[model samples]
Target: MITSIAQAVALFAATNIDDIVVLSLFFARGAKRPHITRTILLGQYLGFFGILTVAAITSYGAVTLLPAGAIPYFGLIPLALGIKAGWDTIRGIDEDEDGAGRSLALPTVAAVTFANGGDNIGVYVPVFVSNSPQVVAVYCGVFLVLVSAMVFLARFIATRPGIGEWLERSERYVFPLVLIVLGIVILAEGHAFGL
Candidate 1:
C-alpha cells in the first residue's frame, strides 16, 4: 500500500507538473473575475478525472487483449505526443494563449485541461495495467487528494506578484521539453525501443 501510494504520487507529479503552470495562469486570469474560480476548479477536476478514466479503461483493455510482452509499446503514445508538441513549437505555433475575448467557460477550461493531459494518459495506462485493482484504487485515492492540493498551490502562486508571470512566460518552452524528456525516459525505462 505504501509503495502504491508512492508510485501514484510520483506518476501524478511527473505527468501533471505542467498543469501547475496552466492552472496558475487560469487562476491569475480569474483573479479579477472571482466567479470563474469555481468554474476553473470544477473543470480541472472533470478533465483530470476524464483523463484517468480513459487511462484506466485503456489499461484494462490492453491487459485483456494484448500479450504481456506488448505492454511496453504503450510508451509510444507519450513519445508521439512529445514529438508533435516539439514540432508545433518549432513551427512557432502557440496553443496555450487565450484569445483576446474568450470567456473562461467551464467547457473551455475542461477541454483545455483534457487536451493538455494527453501525456498523462500515456504514462498512466501502462502503470495502471501493471498494478492490481486494489493498488490502482489506492493510486486513485492518492491522486484525488493531490489534485486538491495542486489547485491550492496553483492558486497561491497565481495570487503572488511576479512568480505567476514568470511561469507563464516559461511554460511554453518548458512544457514541450518536459514532455519530450519524459517520453524518452518512459520509452527507455520500459525498453519500448528495445533499448
Candidate 2:
C-alpha cells in the first residue's frame, strides 16, 4: 500500500511537471473568459482519465500475456520517457508552446493535454501493469487529489504573475531532471535492466 502511494506520487509528479505551465497559461486566460479555469480543469481531468483508461487496457493485456517475472520489464516505459524528456531539454525543444496567446477553449485545452501527455501513457501502463486492481484504485484516488492540488497551485501561481514566470523559466531544467530521477527510481525499484 505504501509503495503504491509513493509510486503514484512519483508518477504524477514526473508526468505533470509540464502541466503546471499549461495550467498557468489557462488560468491567465481565465481573466478574459470567466469560465476558463473550470474549463481547463475539466478538460485536463477528462484528458488525463482518458489516457489512464488506455493505459489500464494495455496493462491488462500485457499482464495476461506475459509471465509474472517479466512484469518488471515494464519499467522501460518510464525510463524511455525520462530519457526522451531529458533529450528534449538538451535539444531546447519546448513542449509547452507560448500558451499566452492561445484562445481558451475546452476542446482545445483537452486536446492539448491529451496530446502532450503521450509520454504519460508509457509511464502509466508499466506502473499499472505491476499492480493489482485494488492498488490501481488507490493510485487513481491519489492521482485525483494530486491533480487537484496541482491545478490550485498553478492557478495561484498564474494569478501571482511573478511566481508563474519564475516557475516557467526554471521548470525547463527542473522538470527534465525530475523525469530522469523518477525513471531511475522506477527502474531500480522494479529491478529492471538486470539490476
Q: Which has the greatest TM-score?
A: 1
lDDT of 2 by residue, 1-195 (tens): 998899899989998897786677556544444566788888888877876776777788843433444445544544564476558768866434544432456765565556455567768878887878999899989988887788888888777767757655665565455545645655565576767
- Whole-model Cα lDDT of every candidate shown, in order: 0.69, 0.67
Q: Return the TM-score for candidate 2, rounded to 2 decimals.
A: 0.61
For all the candidates, what are their Cα RMSDs to the real structure? Answer: 6.5, 8.3
Looking at model 2, how many pairs of residues clash? 0
What is candidate 2's local distance difference test score? 0.67
Q: In candidate 1, residue 150 scores what lDDT? A: 88
lDDT of 1 by residue, 1-195 (tens): 888889889988998887787677666545555466688888888988887887788898843344444545554544565576567768876543553321356765575566566667778878888889899899989998888888888888877768767655665565456555655655665586687
Evaluated against the true structure, the overall lDDT of model 1 is 0.69
TM-score of each: 0.64, 0.61
Residue pairs clashing in model 2 are: none
